[model samples]
Target: MFPIWIHTKEEVKRLLILGAGGFGHMIQETARLLGYEEVVFLDDAVKGADVIGKCCDYKAFLNEYDTAVAALGDSGMRLYWTEKLMEAGYQVPAIIHPSAVVSPSAVIGNGSFIMQSAIVNTNTVVEHGVLVNSGAVVDHDSRVGCGAHIGLGSVVKANCVIPSRKKVEEGEVIFSTRRKIDGVTSRNLEDALYAFGFGLQCSYVKPFGEGHINETYAVYMPTEEGDEFAYILQRVNNNVFKDPAGVMENIFGVTEYLRNVIREEGGDPDRETLSCIKTKNGCTYFEDNEGQPWRCYNYISNSVCYQLVEDPEQFYQSGNSFGHFLKQLGNYPASSLKETIPDFHNTVKRFENLEKALKRDIKNRAITCRPEIAFALDRKQDCKVLVEQQENGTLPLRVTHNDTKLNNILFDAETGKGLCIIDLDTIMPGLAANDFGDSIRFGAATAEEDERDLDKMHFDISLYELYVKGYLEATKDVLTPEEVESLPWGARLMTFECGIRFLTDYLEGDTYFKTAYPEHNLVRARTQFRLVDEMEQQFAKMQEIVREYA
Candidate 1:
């Protein structure tokens, strides 16, 4: 727990507001309402309301007054002042409005504020220098980290983890308890577009998807015919995707070929696959001023994209969509596309990486997750089966959507059929079994990937059967004999591979995936390992089912 000070009104002689902004005035009003007769501001500039001293004069001011509170809103500067004030032997107590309904069980850090009508629910911890603005609710068991702000009227749902220095905008709703990645502001939207040579006047731009990889936005453009069209604007994460050009080239090639294939089959080409909107210079993607890569795609309006498999039928349709995708690209020369992520499905290489991460133990996180580390090490030989076969000219390479999770396929809202496959950045040359296995690894799970209860997490054989049936029905003729035989191994290897990758990332200080908390990656790794263990017990049955479908 962070060091904090709690004081009664009598103990505080006079309060000092650290800022002179709009929020500083609000803080002054709040102090006045609380019966503080002496309140003054310390600001370098913009001296208007009770401006007594500058930040440089804080040392002299602190010598006279022992009680003060930071009134600034910017989280970084709030933290700077909080440390400085604490070091100066000043009492910085949490300020709570009388109207705010804070639970007795809730914990508030020093210099924090719970504004009027704000509710800090049971067991929620509001950390140092934080702000729970008016009418905002920090739900049960959540942690509002130090210097973070819960904006007015914003709803932070249960168990949500807001990191330090992050801001929740007013009236914004965050559904996922998973910590958010970087966010884009309305001010940066136009400059981001202009960086991509997109000169068209956009009607609106807002955050789009819940994907952890990229910063996505939906851009709206009004047509000359008075009809409006929307496009997906994304700033790809350069950390994960090292080769943006190669990634876009893979997407453009696959989507361009998919468009032609859809047209030949009398389907709506635009609705069937993601259509890339090339830059003004005819490049596959644009380079922003910050040297980050940006790309745009025509949004499939009126279509629905699901993050989870709510219905088994929808999951089955997703299998067909991806399997048919493989069938369509069966003849598209997989070798032509560059490997955006090298050794993406090479289980052997993944384990090697995990071993290196363990050896280095850079973050010292490996000591706590000994069980998970042992589980991965025990199954090291299991990772080699698929790689050995691929090297020996057994399993042939195909253009695989390396990420074949159900959510990647967008379903028609009315028809409930898989209409389009989006997020083509990971499209690469790999075994068909990789695509098949990844679907089962995620979609066939009995519980969520991050479920804490190990008992609730299991391999749902019924869901696996459904996907295999749908997939085989679509690609029975197109897939070769070797690829058909490798389906069961694919499921096992993909699950194991994903488990080790998570463990490796955890050991390496979580540089790759976005984690809500410190143990998030470990929880994910444990779930994947659980599924892998269950698949091992049912290995024969999985192969038998694949043969039955074949």
Candidate 2:
């Protein structure tokens, strides 16, 4: 038997959801089924008819709504908002779907949600702010810690314990003391840890980031003081990065050079740059029994990463950080670096790849995206602008950080300045404009890259100006005149090339990029194209801003 939560119509009057995303919608339906008369939503990013106000506006609705639930997907964000709601004197209840089966012996904490068809068997303990997704199962005597997420269809076997804030991937199986996921096993993790000479026994390991190209994990080790996430382990995606050895070689060379530079400039090398941890035999990385390349890095403490541009100053700091990166590597022989991904930023080649995907049309998806197809076709000449300049010896090659998204730069928690530049997998010899342009393409956007509503997407010129000001202030002395002039073109063509790549993947049956739904790639391409259109409309202003900054 389970605790009776089915309230009468008069007993449950109104319910509030802190997040207004897909998960919030599902919670709304579940609330209605549980006899709640009215439900409203508060979201920071979303705007809709049902959204009463932003998340910070919760205090205003206290008199009208007495109960609330934090419906966010990210475990950390969910836990943060849940605490805020509780502090505000709102009843933060554990939301169990009517269809879920929970044993009366199981203990569920407040602010937890047990979704439809999920099961909590005898003696299971699920802590606060945890999410047991649809169809997930928690077996007997198991303990799920605070803010942990049991993904859809995942199984936690008997007597297993999932640590705080850990995430179990969908379809994974967690045995008594081991975990198994696609392509990586518990034995493989143990071997890798041993190879890295991690002196202490590992406390736990869990998925870490939102990167699409690699499998990243945080490795916690027990010490005399306490348990600490001392290192980061990663399995390189061979499908995307064909030459793992060559990639490691480039990273080793760059970090070694960066260490010397930071030391001479009176900076802490460990926090300023990545420190790659080698294997017992002094190898840059270790190969698992399955021949997968695994590497580890010493974790940098007291730093933060932002997924979106919430503040203009942070975006400016990101620009300064990347610009400083370019200036520091200005004298290093750029030509000595290998092309990790051959012709990685070749806008012309990207267009050709899109044409090939259109010809194959294996999924016959091209017909459904004719407008996007035409969008790429019309920009055929635009793609050639930078490639032609590079071929004609007008633009100079430099060491470029191909992935310059804001999240790749870690900001110092104390000073709120950019501390380290990460994700060096795509570092190669390329145009400086491409690096500068990639930042603007992502950081200056008004909405998310995959936002379905086109009306919400726009290019914010003010943010673009802020980035240019910071970048040019740091690299003005090192950059050549021709390179500086090409910055605006970089912004436009990089966005155009990215859209072409997305549309190509959509046509090729979504092979390259990971898609959550059928039209995910298409929706992403639309947002990119929308940004490109706005950039074209404001081209003159963009050039003036770049010139003013330079």
Candidate 3:
């Protein structure tokens, strides 16, 4: 015998929720707030006044209820039960929490639930059985597919479309298919423009760049004088970089020095080096409400950044560009720059960390990877060569771009000449050889860094020769006789160090780098080791090539 009940909304008076989980209970309260007086649940585990017994009795209770809503969190289960309940002659109304701000033009499908503080903006579509979770925002013209979840605090930027059953993780911002951003808002971005001293009429602000380390945005500021300019905005990844202030100091110092050098050479300073924008407070960086640090740079027009080695000539040009960067910074005070990441390229310290991780064996993941462990452990003594040299004062510490990958250099779009070197995150006191070796390690490979097939992963000697030629051409006069001799060793040691790092991260449960699967880091470690082995076999030839260029 059911108690007499009166509902403010006649359509949802006999509402039945099909699950009694956390989401189910939340939905029950949401139903009450929406004027449903007779809310009931059907769960196998919980006992309540309105439970109406287990889900087994759902078929019998269908005739007693006017409408039903799925409170299950799992997309597949929600979608399955949603179709089944509707097939059984019950209406499935979409439930929107009273606090949610939904657009009048948005199309919300049946059985979807919009949670508190979430926004479904204009012309967006929330498909059936989807959950727009708390504090999530689906911006204008977006599509939340059937059974998909817009996770807590996640932002789906405008014109983006998420597919069915896709899960957008908490606080993750999906900019588009090609990029992901985080912790930025349009209001903050606009404020940053004025803060950075840009007073032009702004046209648009959108997420930009294909960089893995920083969250980037392209800000378009159009002037009334018919001049439109774009600026590159970025949020520094404090996780990878410990000291944002120190990093900015290094960048400002280097760019200021480079500007003076370019002026002497009768070259364009803005195109040759990154020009950092100062905030209204006269600082190089801005701090948002979340403590995330953002900085802006002048966008180099008519420039192209390539990800792959489309041409060997382009790779050589990349080498020359980076070489020029080293040459320009040769006179800068090496002691002035702070080590943004301490022991960053310290192979010996890295080996010690690996050994410590191996001893802890916290994740118990060691049992599955004995071969990779032995591969790293066997080369333990090989790691000390560079460290011992640096300590003995045999190898001079010079300012170097620690990340010497090809894409970090931008090329002139029309001329195809390497125009500038960007991404100065790890510019600190380090070996010139490390920079050269990192470039060879990344660019001279026959296959990708994580290629599964070992047979396809040999080092390309011709590409190595080209890069060495270009790099040596720029710095042959500046590098010391001892620094010249250490070039080959840099290639071998950096590759080995990278392999060891990857294997350690794998053994420690894939903590550092993003892994698509459990064995991804292992695969990467193997590829690096393979390249190291090849470099070892061709060690004498590599030295001859460097000497020839020198």
Candidate 4:
């Protein structure tokens, strides 16, 4: 449990961590693992949210503390506690969980908390009070402004700067934006805006917790005192639309539906909260300045919420609710399941791609795979990990959770019952096994996945049991026996699936998973491959356990 948080608290000359969420706990444990042994967790919460893992607190503990990690799940929540701790003058330590694999050359500042599995690569400079959260990777040479909370599992590739107190959240990637101004690329507006006024406070409290993205800002047509409220600055990137047009389109559609639904259900149509203001087509969604794609969606104050939810956990449930909502749109008949790739299990394609890429000298292949360069397998294994599954008719295509982890499941904050899943961008026609297996891998591991003492870390069968019970409880009626039977295999298969990905990356010269060290991806592959071996050894027993649960 996050009892480790006791260590981050400032009241004690040592540390006192507060939360027990896996990310929080990892930070606590990481401090100890990284040689900060005086750490203690002050984990006393009103509910089970306080008892993530083994941590439990009887009576509510007081903040006779200063300088907390502010490692709470929500970026907004982190800011809340951080303000409290700072007001009390408790020195919030800038902690990179010992296992985060930060580049030695990287500079981390005070009050920063780098949670588990984060990868901060070479020359990346992090200012004070940054939150480099779980599974989030800041690629080579990135800069994070003060109090920027990088969210769970998000990817920030290459070079970029996250502004002060901004929260760049889960599952998104950021890259620098440069528009060729007069053939001389001008400074990007979004980047310039984010870098504006270092004292800006952006994160605001939300019903479910705190809002994640700080991609916009609210301002008037020039105030006497420059007074303003919080706003989100839409992220501008090459792969993703900088002008939030695509984003606005889909969101507008969803919210419009929500509004109509509320009105038809006899709810206050006047209560409809959001106002779509047209500011120079590009000002809000599509505009061309700097020749760079820049767009934004400023929050209209005190309108109506498009979606309704009770708490933070409910916020994540939007993913599942979206699924059901999609089903309701029966106007479009559900298409048959089909893999994007034929015989989707085919790993052989990996080799083909790798071979061809090398032949074509794609990007960094030459530098990463040069005979002069050094890495195991000479970086050829990236594509070599694929398999050639026999043609087996067309495989069914169904929406899937490409990245499955516990927090990804939107649980009822009150009941702790998982209501829906979130972060569906990677959804594709894939096997249920992927999601089911990943859920197990994420939660059941004894030591954090990034843990150094490999021996102390392994899958926790009890957690695995709980995951299966809960997962099956929700999905059993619709899942087939074969699918259920394959649950154990699912874990191993997913491990191999990831091992292949890691290995594939290894062959590709470590381009996919950001590495903090020379052999970071290799180490990741070893960890996953070892887990796969462990899964294989216990395959029969695991299957039996699944059978019992089923």
Candidate 3 C-alpha lDDT tens digits along 1-550: 1111111234457699999989999999998999888888999898878788777677888778868877888888887787777777777888888899988888888788999999999988787888899999999878888889889999998767899889999999997332222323655565566567553335556787766567788877666765344788888878778799999999999999999999998999989899988886899898776677889998998999887678899879978888888898889999999999999889999999889989998888788778878888898998988888888998899999998888889899999999988899888999988898898898898887878999999999999999988888888988898888888899899988888888889878887766778898889989999999899899999999998888
Give the per-residue lDDT of model 2 (tens digit) for 312-339.
9999999999999999888788887878
lDDT of each model, Cα atoms only? 0.85, 0.88, 0.84, 0.51
How far does residue 429 in candidate 2 sit from its true spot (Å)? 0.2
Q: How many clashing pairs per prediction, in order?
A: 0, 0, 0, 46
If both were scored by TM-score, which would come out higher, candidate 2 or candidate 4?
2
Ranking by lDDT: 2, 1, 3, 4
Q: Evaluate model 3: give its TM-score.
A: 0.64
> lDDT by residue for model 4 over 1-550, one digit each (tens)?
0011212323234465656666667676766765654555544452343232222321233344333555565555555565555555566667766557688778776657877788998988877657888789998767887668888899887667787778786788887633222211223443434343211222221122222222223432234565344333333342323334444543444445545754665654333323333343234443435543433334433322212233333323332333333332222222332222233333345435545545555445345534322232343343222121113422222344445655544444444434433332233345555567766665565554445566865765656666666566555665567667756766766665555555556556665555566655545655665576677677777888778867
Model 4 misplacement above 4 A: 1-395, 410-420
- Per-residue lDDT for 325 in model 3? 87
10 residues in a row with least lDDT, candidate 1 = 178-187
Candidate 2 C-alpha error for residue 503, in Å? 1.2
lDDT for residue 231 in candidate 2, whole number 0-100:
89
- Runs with alpha carbons beyond 4 Å of true place in candidate 2: 1-185
Prediction 2 global C-alpha lDDT: 0.88
lDDT of 4 at 117: 81
Task: Provide TM-scores for the models.
Answer: 0.65, 0.66, 0.64, 0.42
Q: Which of 1 and 2 is the better model by TM-score? A: 2
- Point out the higher-scoring one by TM-score: 2 or 3: 2
lDDT of 4 at 412: 40
